[model samples]
Target chain A: MKIAIDAMGGDHAPEEIVKGVEMARDRYPELEFMLFGTESEVKPLIQSMDRLELIPTTEVIAMGDEPVKAMKEKQDSSLVQAANAVKEGKADALFSAGNTGALLSSAIFIVGRIRGVERPALATAFPAFGGPHREFVFMDLGANAENKPSHLYQYGILGTFYAESVMGISNPRVRLLNNGGEEDKGDDVHKAAHQLMKNTDAFNFLGNVEAREIMEGTADVVVADGFSGNATLKAIEGTALTMMGQIKEAIKGSGIRGILGALMLKPALKAMKHKMDFQENGGAVVLGVKAPVVKTHGSAKANAVANSMGQIQTMVEGKLVDKTAEFIKENADKLKVKKAAK
Target chain B: MKIAIDAMGGDHAPEEIVKGVEMARDRYPELEFMLFGTESEVKPLIQSMDRLELIPTTEVIAMGDEPVKAMKEKQDSSLVQAANAVKEGKADALFSAGNTGALLSSAIFIVGRIRGVERPALATAFPAFGGPHREFVFMDLGANAENKPSHLYQYGILGTFYAESVMGISNPRVRLLNNGGEEDKGDDVHKAAHQLMKNTDAFNFLGNVEAREIMEGTADVVVADGFSGNATLKAIEGTALTMMGQIKEAIKGSGIRGILGALMLKPALKAMKHKMDFQENGGAVVLGVKAPVVKTHGSAKANAVANSMGQIQTMVEGKLVDKTAEFIKENADKLKVKKAAK
Candidate 1:
């Protein structure tokens, strides 16, 4: 299997992306990689032999550029070209750490979405505590503007499948993210989503799950609208950072107790930090596309890029395409019925 | 000053509430207290006191009980009676650790709204690290179901005055919460709110702020419609709690490194815990109302209740009512213009 990598994207750009490609190629000798970027920039970074190929491109999409406009105008850009390669079946998957919106639009416009998928979503698997712990998949991190009840139901389905196929979780417990833990907690959209999840036999639908419960590993698949999901993801990130900062400040405070405690708990704090770190997971997947499309953070480093590539390889080896196709085929009549009901 | 306490409205009910009232009465010699609950339940807890009085009734509102239904049918309920005390001018403010929805609706329906205030919002000042060490006031915590652009603008106005008066922050920075930092980041409502805020002269508008920026002390007032605001607040709370739990687990993990680190960082982690703890703030003020009302967490202890009562005293002494009135008078014409433009 061959995966296309956008070497001109992200903070580390050619350096990190190139390193990731070399690492993945080295680890998996049979796997092939198609690197897209300027030849000059890609040459020095390519240190390995065999399996790896270069698809040189002249244009680079800036992180600030309008996604739709950039996708449409930059015909020769690395992002669009990489996406086009997947659309044309030159590569099985496309990986990028560029502007998320640009990547999303390119995937939707160029690579095209899988049949029966209405809206694509960004799904992240956050690490959690307690038993049965590999964390849960939450969508859409930053995709659609407003999500209908059906969208949330679809997110639940996609998230569960992704968890099962990608993360190796069986019978993932899907949940609706609501303000309160009760059935009547959320507003109209949430209420509708809750009802749809309960009524549908598509997956294991856990009743309404609160934010606190999600943190405690209550659900394997958490579903919400794009606005709430994005806001929730960011809030969690900010809160974690804030806690880390506060922990640092408290350790630095000029006092005997502070110094004593800091000395005693240094290792414990490091353990805590490692557990909450998002870098270990590398990047999120823009699920529901026809082919695998991993959207790494724009500021991702070499390790994150490598992990993203590995994720794509793992998905490919696990036969995600076939599983998704089968799932869609099996749920076709029900999906159409759901559409009509909506 | 007189304050009404919902003696039977929390997990601890009359026991904690009575203890809080006793503490408040002892701390403030001249302050009058009226405790509301069923005579049979409250009499046992109501010990002899000079300044504290018990207004025993026959009704009680359960935690899971419907807010509007309880308010309408159980007129003599402790929560309703407490609100009635404020409405009858027998109390300066009302405090409840009960159903948030019940308090908000009862306050609006029975106590009445301030003139020119279209919808009274439930505002809470969230603790943050910044200059002068002030907390940002977020509005419509759980009041409105769906928020329009206009409601956001009003929430901004209310939050600004709340910070300025209660928190004593001059010229507080007001920000609208959005999915992205860009102008075109959100749906139509966010764009409209941005335009309105840019045009309004009454606020120190700071444009758009994403959820991740909140912990970095982005603004003194972050405004959003109730739905998003409530979801964001809960998400943050969930994230903080989750991180704290993870930190605890990490420190307790196997090996001497984890144990040593947990020991060293014990004091520091405690400090960090205190910083993120909502219990530290005591209670959240119900802003945009005619009079000051505070809602403590339903599971609050005596200390939280006492602190909330103290907050009421400080707000009253600070002339928060006059400040809110002055703000309404000043921004009346500008709000009219914005509405007209819409």
Candidate 2:
């Protein structure tokens, strides 16, 4: 399989991106990379890696650039070129640690969406507790902020497919992210979406799951609109960071004993940190699209980029995009018929 | 000053409820309590304490009961009676560690909304980092599941007053809770709300605030619709719990050195726990109401209940209801005039 890499993006750009490609090449000998970036910067970093092919691009999309405009105008930019490679069938997947919006725009406009899909959602993987599953899928993580009930229902279907195909979960219990677990909870959109999802036999529906119960691993796929999902995702991230900061302060204030305790608890603390780290989780995938497109954090280093490559490889090997397209094509007519009947 | 107590509410009921009242009475000698519950269950717990009056009632609202229906039918229930006491001017405020929905129902139906207030919001305090202010107030924490742009604008006004008066923060910076900090972020409702808030001089509007910046003390007041706010609030709570659970597992898996390290770091961990504890932050306050009504957690023990009482006492002493009424009355005409001009 071949993966397209946007090397002129993220904090550690060309250097880390090239290093990551090298690492992935060493690990997965069957996999190849088409690195897109300025030749001068990316060429030195390649270091005679045989499996890697440099696709030189002149322009670079800055982190703060407007997404749609940048994608449209910066045709020669690494991000756009990388996405185009997937569009032209030169690469199986597109990977980037660039400006999220720009990457999303490129993925949607360049890599394209699956047939019969209204909107593609960005799916984030969050670590879960009290279940055999290590993590669950949360979708629309900021793709389409304003979503109709139909959009949300589609997210459930897309999330279900992604969970089953990519995450290797069978049946992948899907639940609507809501204020309360009860059937009669949430706003009008949620209520309508819940009913639609409940009536469908496309996946395992587990009713509405509250945000407090989400981390408890109550469901494998939690679907929500982009707005609520983004807020909830950030809230979880912020709370974890705040708690860790508070713990650090506590350790600092405890004098000599605290310093010794820190040394003894280093391994445990490291383990906990690793568990909470986004780098370990690879990156968020843009589902409902024609091809696999992963967006890692802009600050992601070599290891995280390598993990993202591995994740993309898995998605490609598992034929997630093809499966999603087939599912949507098969069920789109049935869903419309059901809606008309209702 | 007098406060009404729902003695038969919460998991602990009369035992912890009466104990909390006693603790509050001892701490604030100027305050008196009107405990509402069955005399058989509450009288023994009261222990003939001075300034404590047991108002006997027969009915009890279960935790799982429908809020509106329970409040209407269970008129003689402790939750209903306590709210009635505040409405009747027999108590300065009402405090409960009960079914949150029931308490909110009673607060709205019995105690009533302040003039010009369309909906009463539930405001929760979250701890902040690296600031003189230890916490900030987040509003509409699950009061109205479906909120219009106007409702969110009103929340800003209500949240501003609650923060300044009750939280004792003068000229508190108010922000709209959105998917991103950018002005163009969020759904349609948020965009309209942002425009409304920006046009107003009633509060120190700080534009949009993302969920990730909430715990970092970026703003003094974060206003969101009930759906997003509740999801964000629960996400924070769940993340904290999950992290603590993970830490426990880590310590257990780390052998004797880790156990000894835990002992040495016990005080620091305890301090960190206290900071994150809901009891330390008191409880969510029902804002835009005629009286200060606070709802503690359902499983609240004596200390949490006591903290909630103290919070209510502070609200009553600061005349939060009167101030809110004044602010609304003063700004209502101006807001209308501005709307007409627009």
Candidate 3:
């Protein structure tokens, strides 16, 4: 399987990207990489070009650049070219650690969405600490500022497919992210979505799941409108970061006891951080697209990039996009239903 | 000043409720409490009758009872009667450590909304670490499953008054809790809310704030539509609880070193927990009501109950309801504007 790499993406850019490519290439013998970046800069960072082929390109999409505008203007940019490689069938999947908005734009507008998909959702298998499952798929994580109830219903389908095809979860249990655990909770959009999802024989519909229960592994796939999804994801992340920061402060302020405790608890703390790290689950997959379009955090190191490559390899091997397209085609009528319209 | 209390409405009920009342009664010589509950079950828990009066009631609103349904049927319930006391001007405020929904229902239906307020918000002063403030007020926390742009704008005013009158923060900075930090991020309602707030000369409007920044005290008061607010609040809470649980598990699984670390880190962990505890800041206030109506956790102990009393005292002393009413009267035209219609 071949993966198109936007080597000029991310804060670490060509250096980390090249190192990650090298790592992934060495680990998976069947995998090949088409690294896109400025030849002069990215060429020297390459350790071994055995399974890695450098497809040089100019222009870099900065983190702050407007997504759609940048994609339109930066035609020769590595991100755009890399996306084009997948669209042209030269690569099985597209991977980047660049500006999230830009990569999303490239994934949606460049490689394109699946036939019936109105919006391609950004899905990630976040860690589920206390639940039976180690991780569960959550989607529409800020892909769009707004989403219709029908879009949420679509996310359930997309998320279900991702979990089944990629994560190997059989009959993935899908649930709507609601204000309360009850069926009759949430706003008009969510209430309508609950009814829509509950009535469907599409996947394993397990009713509504609250934000407080997401980490508890209440369901295999949690669907949400983009706005709430974004807020929920960020809140969970922010809380974890803040608590850990507070612990660090407590240790520093505690003097001798804290120093000794820190040394003794180093392993436990290390394990916790590792579990919480995005690198553990690779990057987010922009599902409902024609091909696997993945993105790691911009600050992701070589390990994270390598993990993303492994994730992409699984998606490619499992034929997630193809399977999703087939499923959407089969559920054509359901996908087109406007029952959730206000 | 007099305060009505729902002594029968909690997991620990009359015992914890009476204990909390005694703590508050002893602390505040000028304050009076009107406790409503089953006389047999509650009379034994009372230590002092000075400044504490028990009003016997027959019905008990169960945790699972529907809010509005229970409110109408269980008229003589502790929660309902306490709310009624506030409504009839027999009590200055209403406090409960019971069914949040029931309390909110009673507050809205019985205590009533302040003159022109459309929806009352559940406002809580959650702790803020690594910032300029100890805690910042967050509103519309599941009070309404849906909130209009005008409601969000009203939260700004209500939250500002709570900060100023209750918490003594003057010219409090209010921000809209949005999907992104940018001024132009979020759904139609939030986008419209941003525009509405930005143009208003009524309050100190500080653009948009993401859920990630709430802990960092990006704003003194954060306004959000009820749905997003509920999601954000739960996400923050769930994350904290989950992380703490994970840390405990880590410590337990780490053996001798972990035990020693736990002992040394005891004080630091305690301090962190204290800072994060709801007891430290009291319960959520049902704002935009005719009078202060508060609800603490159902499992709250004596200390938490006492904290709520102190919070109620501040609200009453500051004349939060009267001041909010005055402000609403001044900004009547702004409050009634429905610019966020889809």
Please name the candidate that would achieve the greatest lDDT relative to the true structure: 3
Q: After aligning candidate 3 to the native by TM-score, how far in Å is the CA of A32 from where it should be? A: 1.1
- What C-alpha lDDT do the candidate models reach, one value each? 0.82, 0.87, 0.88
In model 3, which regions exceed 4 Å deviation? A336-342, B334-342
i-RMS for every candidate (Å) is 2.4, 0.8, 0.8
What is residue B26's positional error in candidate 2, in angstroms? Answer: 0.8
The C-alpha TM-scores of every prediction are 0.96, 0.97, 0.97
Q: Write down the TM-score for model 2.
A: 0.97
* Comparing 2 and 3 on lDDT, the stronger one: 3
Point out the worst 10-residue segment of candidate 3 chain B by lDDT.
B333-342
Q: Say which candidate scores most in DockQ.
A: 2
Which docking class does model 2 fall in? Answer: high
Residue-level lDDT of model 1, residues B235-254, one tens digit each, is 88887887777767765674
Candidate 2, residues A17-53: lDDT per residue as tens digits?
8888888787787899999999999998887768889
The residue-level lDDT of candidate 2 at B259 comes to 89
Between candidates 1 and 2, name the one with more favorable lDDT: 2
- lDDT per residue as tens, model 3, B1-342: 999999998899989989999999888878999999999999988887998899999999998888899999999999999999988999999999888999998998999999888788999998877557778899889999887787887788899999999888889999999987777777788888888888887789989989987889878999988888899998888888888888888999999999899889989988888787754569999999999998989899898899889999999999999999998898777665643342
Clash statistics: count for each candidate = 9, 0, 0
The list of candidate 2 runs beyond 4 A from truth reads: A338-342, B337-342
Q: List per-candidate RMSD values in Å.
A: 1.9, 1.6, 1.7
Name the lDDT of candidate 3: 0.88
